[model samples]
Target chain A: MKTINLAESTVRDLNQALHDQAIECTEREWEVLEPKGQHNIACGLDQNISVDIKGPTGYFCAGMNKKAHITIHGNAGQGVAENMMSGSVRVKGNASQAAGATAHGGLLVIEGDAGARCGISMKGVDIVVKGSVGHMSCFMGQAGSLVVCGDAGDALGDSLYETHIYVKGEVKSLGADCIAKEMRDEHIEELSELLNRAGVDEDVTAFKRYGTARQLYNFKVDNTAAY
Target chain B: MCGIVGLYLKNKALENQLGELFEPMLIAMTDRGPDSAGFAIYGDEVPEGSIKLTLRHANEDYDWAGLAGKLKHELNVGVEWFNNSKVAIFKIATSDGIAEAFITENAPDVLILSAGQSIEILKEVGLPVNIAKTFNLKGMKGSHIIGHTRMATESAVTMEGSHPFSTGMDLCLVHNGSLSNHNRLRQELQREGIVFETENDSEVAAGYLTWRLKQGDTLNEALTNSLKDLDGFFTFTVGTRDGFAVMRDPIACKPAVMAETDDYVAMASEYQALTTLPGIENAKIWEPEAATIYVWERSSETGVK
Candidate 1:
């Protein structure tokens, strides 16, 4: 195992060391000590390595990842796993706003509650939150799956498209072009897989599904008032 | 964007180290707001019928003792003062209004930063580190502190435009977002006899709270009313005599994270400002919900437990 203490080294040093693995690929496991809530930790990594951050992180932790798996043991700041291509990011504690924002493909699991705008504008990513999510979760999401094992805040899944949203607890308010949909067998299967991948043990049947109503897919003159 | 950091020590044992712990928190947020920095510390209370005033002059070599001597001669009240950087802290055994009137008439160039029993505000247009060092912030002992670093979105980069604005006695506010209707609100508040020092939107917010408190509204109630009346994004941390309160606008675009332990309750715009705190690993950390008011006061029985 490789260890980098942030108290001694800067974030640039840590990212450079992690990025070096893309060419040589010698170290498969890494640990970061004293994360100290700094920004841009382990960002832009393309290697298939696992990095464990021992403390809370600042903005854009594990941002723009390709094939690396990152785990934050404490809370995460804004935009964790933003614009990721592939791989996984796990936040063991609560996350600030815009978790998994604009990520193309990856799996992001948040064990604690998340602030506003979780999974915003996501494309082809899968997110599972063990606790509640704040307002405007999954806003303008194009393609992804957001599974919440707990409650959801106001305006859930606003202007969504082709994204599956599963919430086990209460939803404060559904956003425009978003409504509760009937949970079919395929949705149940998909949610069960996401929950299992996120290591959340919950009954799949207890969840309700929400998605775009397909009315806003094309701008109709009748829908002008809603806009 | 601006950054706000506040620390309220619940344990009296940590009172002496308040500035030592809070100085780094403000310094860590330099990137967020590097235009200006300021803070309002609540400590060193004066006796009954006495108020402490924090005054600032552009000239660092201004004679603060001369001003105090003149104030004593005019107000007929014993006045004692000390200087910190370009600011001066004065303890006068008189009413806040009378002392302020005397200063405004006699020392026209002096800017009254704050006037209260326990609050002292110091602000300057500079980086947080330089401001901290110049003000000797590391040695300041206090029970609670509220600070701000400004990037100057709504107004100019002058010291008057900096945050931690005080519009009332022992009450101040630090904000992290812009208000859209401040110009209109300022006109309305001015008609109600609320005096504003600058065109900064944050000063208007502080004035609004002062107006509300004058209307017999509690801090929590005033904040709830602000959520409805004030437009635009805001994450405000307000410091009062007995306690402090935090509130964010309904949209909550501006971020605010709070952590509390047995010893203290700390808040900042991001987690980075709180990383240097002791026992933070075990603190109960959470993001304050949108449009919610969170208040912690130094109670008579158990203090800020």
Candidate 2:
């Protein structure tokens, strides 16, 4: 196992060294020895790399991520996989706001908690969080699926369009146009797929579903009843 | 628009106001509002009876002690003692008008804002470090800090109108959105002899808030009043020497996040701006409650866990 430790180096030095070493690590690299508030540590990776960040990160740790598989052992700051187009980021600890905001495509999994606006304005990103999200989570979401294993805060899925939200726990309040929806067969299948991808071991059948009721999708006089 | 950030170290509550917690975070975001930057930092270690002030008007001759006395008088209180700076620091908790009277006399466009217990305001057109350092910014020993970077959207980017604008001696305000009813509020407040120097709608906000604070109303009370009285999109953070306050319009138009750790708290205009703060042990983040005012006090030595 090749272990490049960042014992005394800042997140900046470690990232630079990783990039300079040209080590296209295939397996999970042993450790990020010492990381103090490092930001954008594993951004924009195209290789099939597996990384294990030893400690917490500052912000946007794997933003714009693609192809590589990454994991962080400790808590993470805001915008973890923001604008990511593909691949995966597994956060073992709680995450800050906008965890997977504006990702066109990708898989983001959080084993712990996430802050407000998780997956906000998400464009085709698949995100799974184990804990609660603060208010206005998934605001202005265009597409994709956001799964929450725990409770969701106020205004969940506010101003959403097309994006599907699956929450296993109780919801504090629904956003402007968001309403409860029946979990159908296709939804169960999709939830299972996302759960498996995020390494969530729970059975998909246990979770309830919530989504945009399509009431406010387009403005019209007749639609006013549902809106 | 300004890059304003602050964090109040409550034992357990949402993050906000007092200026100390936001230091470098807003500094990084200084590029967004580089015209000028000033901060109010509060700390547990600062001695009593000493005042901290930020001085930025280079063209004028000023009297620090005399200004401090005026601060004591107009606030309608007694001054025990004060510490002088290009920016002055006051350790005495006189009436609110004391600080305002001083700022009024000096006319350097001062901001009587603070994180939890310190007020510092500097007005100039430049980078963050340029103005912040002149007031010994990085050297501050505080629990939180709030600052502003000016983009000069509406009003002339003068030293007077720069954020953290002050109305009450202990209160300063920084804003991120336009006030739709500024003209109306301006007219109303001006009719009451509340003088304004610039066209920035935030000034109206500051004026509105300061007037309310002077009426013996709490920060939260004034902020709550703003929801109905003030129109348009706004996300504002206000700081008092001992407490921090925040308010967002009903629309949640502009962005501001409350992110905190056990020891520190942070608020910023964007997620990218908080990319440099320390301690994120499961850092839970939240948005300001729309049209709601949240106020918090710094964790004091009273040992109220």
Candidate 3:
């Protein structure tokens, strides 16, 4: 395993090394040390490799990632794994707002709680949080699924679209158009697969599904009050 | 976008190093906000019934020394003043209302930055690093400090528009993010007899908190009220006489991270600001939940925990 110390190496050097190895088709395991909660660490990686960050990271860590498996041992700042495509980002600790925001296709997992808007405007990214999520966790989500193991804050899945939400705990409130839906066999199977992928063990039967009511999908005049 | 940094030392051992720890944190956010910077430091509690006011004037040559003598003679009270460029802080044995009224009537051009027993606010339009040096912020010692670097999305870049806005005694607020309904809220607050010093949306938020506190709401309750009443994307870190608090808007588009240890509790718009803090690696770091009030007060009533 190759090790890079953020205190000694610049972010550019780290990214360049990762990019070079990815382009060369050299599979390498990398470890980042002394990250010290720096911003933009391991961002914009397009490698099919594994990178473990020893400490917390600031905004946009692993942003725009593609085909990389990034793990943060400590908490992450805002927008961790944002806009990711075809990769997995895991945070052992909590994540700040907008985690995995606007991502197209990837799996993001948070072992601890997540701040607001965890999957805001998300498209096709699957998110699994083992702990509670703050308000508006799935605001305007377009596709994929959000699985929460703990209670959800107010306005969960506000104005959601297409995305499926499975919460094992109580939801403080739901946003416009986002309503609890039936959890069928297919949904339970999907949630079980996601939980398994995130390495979380929980009974699929304990979760409730939430999705858009489809009433405001066409922007009818009757829904003006909701807007 | 803007950057905010707050450091509240739970252990009195870290009091003297408040500025030393906060300076690097504030400067780390230079990329987020470069237009202006400001800070509110809490320390040196004045005697009972006395107040401290930090004031500023547009004219660099404004005679702060002369104003101190005049205030002493006119108010018939003891007044001590410290001048820094366009800013001057006054300590007077008088009520906050009386001193504020005196300044309003006598020195109409001087803008009051803060008035409290323990808070001293210094802010100006410049890069965060430059502003820190200009105010000699690294040399100031306090129990807790809150700082802001503003990019000026809602208002022009001026000292008045800069953050760490103080609308209540020993209370100051620094915000990151713009308010969507500031104009309407400002009008509402104005109608309720709350005066504003700037057109900045953050000032309205500060005024709202001050108004709520005046109505007998605790700081935590006031922050809770803000979540329902204020409309916008905001991450606020507020400093008070006894402690500091943090709250994020429900949507919470703006970023905020907090770290707590046995010795101190620190908050920043980004975790990078906290990297330089002592014992940060072992600190219990987490992202503050949306619309939740996280308060840390020095246990004065019942000794330190």
Candidate 4:
């Protein structure tokens, strides 16, 4: 394992170390010290390595990540794990707005609450939040699953499509074309698998599923009011 | 994008260090907004029935002393003034309206930044670090402070366009996101006889709150009404005579985080702004809910109303 002190090293150095796939290199794990809530740390990584950030991070940390495992010990600013292609990013504390936004593939876990638009425009990412999510979480989600152990704010899953949402707590409101759906056995099993992978110990039966009603999928003139 | 930082000290021991503590927090968000920066400090309450107005002139050669003398002669009150470069602060033993009228009629080139017993607003079109140095923000002493760095999406980058907009006496507002309905709202406010300083959308928000507070609404009530009346993505941190308040729009597209310790309650656009505070590691940190008003007051007797 190699240790990189952000206090003494630039974000470029950290990215360089993470992108170094030389044959002579042996270290696969790295520790980021004194992050001090810097923005865009460990961003744009395309390696199957692990990065443990010691403290909080500012906006867009681990953004556009691919094939990397990133863990933040403290809070994260806006858009954490945004547009990620692959790999996992875990925030031990709370996350600000747009967490896991527009990600295609990967698993993003928040042990604490996530701010507004937690999974907005998500394509194919699996997001698990142990705490509450603010307004507009999972807005316009196209695919993948978002599981919340705590309450969800207003307009949950607004304009959602094909995404599966499981919440154990109360939902403030649902957005246009988003409605509560029945939890079938397959969904229950999938939620169980996701919970197990995220290392959360919540009962699958405690959760409720929500998704798009598919009424506005084709944009018929009869459904113009919903627009 | 913009950056905001606010600190409300619960413990009197930290009051003297308010500027020292807030400077770094403002500078931390340099990348978020670098066009301009501003802050409002609440300290040194004037004697009862008196007010302090911080004024700025575009002409550095403007005679602030002559203006102060004229105000004293015209208003028939005691006026003490301190001039710092293009900015002048006057402490007057008179009604704010009277002093404001006098300044408007006499020092037409001067712009009144703020008028209150405790609040002093200093802002300029420069980087956060340079603004801080120009205003000597590190030496200021206050009970609470609210600062902003602007990227200027809705308005031009000018001194008047910088934030911490003071629309009401001892009250100011700093906004992070743009408003969609500011033009219509500004017209509506204008019809109601509300005067605006700049074309910035944020000024309309400040004016709206000022109108509400003048209509006998409390801070929380005004902010609550804003959630319904204002249409946009916004994260607002308001500074009052006593303490401060924070709120986000319903959709909450913008980011905001708050941290509270026994000694203070701090809020910023990001968590890094609060990391330098004492005991932050043990502080209770959370994101304020969208459209929910979170307020803290200095006087224990005055709870959130």
Candidate 5:
């Protein structure tokens, strides 16, 4: 196990050390101490290692991760694990806005509530929140799946495309062209697999699925006045 | 991108260390706003019928004593003042408009940053660390404080453009986002007798709140009404005589994090600012919801009201 103290070394040094693992794979497990809510800790790691961040973090913590399993012991600031390509990131506490934003791939499991824009513009990421999510959770989501065990705020999946959304609790209001869809066997199986991956113990059959209505996918002259 | 930080002490024992606890929170936001920095601290309440005014002059050698002497000789009012650098605090026993008018008429160059029973605002165009040091922020004691570091998006980086804009008695505001409809709103407020000091959009926000408060609205009421009337993205931390309040716009593009401990309630634009506070690890921290008003007051039985 490799230990890095943020109090003693800079975030650059920490990230550089983590990035170095891709070149030469010696140490596989890393522990970060005293994160002190600094931005960009353990970000942009391409190696397949496990990192445990021991404290709360500021913006963009573990952002743009390609292949790394990172776990935050405390709350994460804005855009945590944003734009990740692969691997998994787990936040033990609440996450601020835009968690897993625009990530192409990965599994993000937030044990606590997530702030607004939880998985905005995500391409292929699978996010499961054990607690509620704030408004505008998955705006313009192109792909991926968002699972909310608790209540969801307004505009769950606005202007979405090919993204699957499952919620066990109340959704405040759906966005334009977003509506509740049938929960089929395949969806339940998919949601079950996602919940199992996120380590969440919940009844998959009790969830409702929502997706794009496919109304605004193409421009229509009849809707030109609304535009 | 501006930075806003506020500390409201719930425990009376922590009052004396308000500045000491708040300085690091302000300095931590240096990267967010490096053009200018300012803070409004609420403490040292004057007796009834008296007000404290924080005055700033362009020249550091501006004789504050002479100004006080002139006011004492002309207005026949007792004036006690404390001067530091180009800023001075004048405590005078007078009515609402007399002292402020006299100072403006007598000394046009001297800008009255704040006038209230308990509020003193210090702000300048510089780094947050240097501004905090210049104001001796670490040694001063207060019950509550609201600070701002500005990266000046909507206006020039002038002292007048700095935040913690005071528009009402014992009430000041520091903002982290830009106001879009300030020009039209400023015209409407000016027509309603609300005074504006600068072209900055944040001052317009302060003026709008002052107008609402003048209409017999409480601090929380005024902030709630601002959501409907004010346009643009903003996360504001307001300082009153009793305590402080935090409000974010409905859009809430700008960030705001709040933490509440047994000792104090701290708020900043980012979580990093609260990291330096004592017992922060155990504090109940959360992001304040959009278009919501969170107020903490000493007079209230419960800290949040």
Candidate 6:
């Protein structure tokens, strides 16, 4: 197993080096020894690879990734895993604002809290935050699954489409067109599977699911007030 | 109506061929502005530059040769006319302070667009297709770019009346909405000896902002000042030499979203205008704060646990 030392290099240098090597998959890991506030690390990798980042990362870390399993040991900044696709991204710590915003497909597992608009405009992805999520968690979500163990902020699932949101804690309030659906056996099963994938120790039977009532799918002249 | 689109590849080594990358995006939003277009693509190896001195003729009459010669002597760069008599873009040699000095003395209304190694702009008046071919934007290649289309409402529809105008130095601006305090600011800037060009609110905002930045405020600070001072419904994105900033008016009256990924961040007036090809996946998208300023550098550093 080779280790990639990023001690002396800037984030730009390390990112370029990784991209140039085309070293998609290996035991080789990049360690960020002393990072200040840096942004956009390990972005746009379309190959299947395993990367482990040691410390806290700045904004837009591991964004727009596909077919790569990236894990962050520390907290991630705004727009963490923005537009991830067809892969698994697990954050061992909390995530900043707009976590998993507009992700088309993939899985983002955040061990801690997520800031506002956590899944805003989520296209098709599954986000499992072990802790709480901030306000407007699922604004204009088209399709996805968000499982939160802690309470969700106001407008948790506003303007949602096909995405299924499951939260264990109290919901402050629901945004327009979002409501708490009955927690059925299938929902619990889905929650259980997601929890397993995220490696959460929490039991599967204790969560409630939320989603859109499908009142605002197509555009309506009468609904001009909503926009 | 002018539309400007800017893109940045988070870690990609973007260089040279900015016109190539910007061509498609400009073409996509041709309907926004149909008058005239121009651009400047910065690179890591490129020298630091100041602003673009945009001249908009009020009543469509002005002294061309005399002004050109005067600016050439003062700023040490020959003026290049980009549009008809309506527009001219000067590649001036000056610092932020000098640029401010020029604005304070002349009080010309400028539109600040995008800057930085990753940001480049392409804009035109009639059709994006014509501008693309004329500039050969389709054949170029770069990791990031921005484009603009113009439709004049408050402005003259002349070359200077389009989108993405600046002071021939550090700042570039593209606006999607109008400013409420434009006339008031215009009067204020005029009193400061900043020459007025067109009656465009975008220019007044740019001029006022450039002057503010020269006063030692960061771009965000200047933007904050504008937000507090300039009223009305608007959304604007500005690019500087190493950074880019986006802001909305007090009402958040216009639509602007930051669709970001590990690869890049896309901001546009409308979501559909941004999601044309969709290369990046699994990226999150969010909205900027109302009446707030958000800025980011060209690249970022990342790691995993």
Count of clashing pairs, candidate 2: 32
lDDT of 1: 0.92
Put down candidate 4 lDDT per residue, A1-227, tens digits, no spaces.
89999999998888787877432346778899999888899999888888999988988999999988999999998899999999999999999889999999999999999988999999999999999998899999999999999999889999999999999999999989899999999999999999998999998999999999998788588768986
Q: Identify the runs in model 4 with alpha carbons over 4 angstroms from their true place.
A: A22-25, A221-227, B300-305
Q: DockQ for each candidate?
A: 0.85, 0.14, 0.67, 0.77, 0.89, 0.03
Q: Tell me, by DockQ, which candidate is best.
A: 5
Candidate number with the higher DockQ (2 or 4): 4
> Which numbered prediction scores highest in TM-score against the true structure?
5
Clashes of 6: 67
Q: Residue-wise lDDT of candidate 1 within B256-300, one digit each (tens)?
A: 999989899999999999988999999999998888888888873
Per-residue lDDT of candidate 5, residues A1-90 (tens digit): 999999999999999999999999899999999998999998999999999999999999989998899999999999999999999999
lDDT string for model 6 (B1-305, tens) is: 45566765564643444454456666655555666555434443223554444443443355556565666678666444343334334444543556435544764543323333233444445676876675566655555555567666776766566666563244677787777779988998888777666898888887887778767886767888887788776778776655467787754546565667766666754433454434532346455656667776654322100
**Local distance difference test, each candidate:** 0.92, 0.71, 0.89, 0.91, 0.93, 0.67
Task: In model 1, state the lDDT of residue A218.
Answer: 79
Clashing pairs in 4: none
Candidate 3 lDDT, tens digit per residue, B193-297?
899978999999999998999889988788888888988799998888988888888756788888888888899988899999988988888777667777878
**On a 0 to 100 scale, what is the lDDT of residue B27 in model 6?**
62
Write the residue-wise lDDT of candidate 1 on A1-227 in tens digits. 99999999999999999999999999999999999999999999999999999999999999999899999999999999999899999999999999999999989999999899999999989999999999999999899899998899999999988889999999999988999999999998998889888889999999999999987787688768996
Give the DockQ-based CAPRI class for model 1. Answer: high
For B1-305, candidate 5 gives per-residue lDDT tens digits of 99999998888898889889999999999999999999999899899998899999999999999999988889889899998778999999885678899989989999999999999999999999999999899998988999999999888889999988996899999999888899999999999998887799999999998999999998888998999999899999999898888899997889999998888888999999999899999999999988988888887736455
The alpha-carbon lDDT assigned to residue B93 of candidate 1 equals: 91
Clash pairs (backbone) in predicted model 3: none
- TM-score pick, better of 2 and 3: 3
Model 1 residue pairs with clashes: none
| Clashes per candidate (backbone, < 3 Å) | 0, 32, 0, 0, 0, 67
lDDT of 1 at B176: 95
The runs of at least 3 residues in candidate 2 whose Cα sits more than 4 Å from the true structure, single-residue gaps closed, are A1-41, A54-60, A73-78, A121-123, A139-143, A158-161, A203-205, A215-227, B7-29, B41-57, B60-120, B138-145, B177-180, B231-235, B248-292, B298-305
Q: What docking class should model 6 receive?
A: incorrect
Worst 10 residues of 6 chain B by lDDT: B110-119
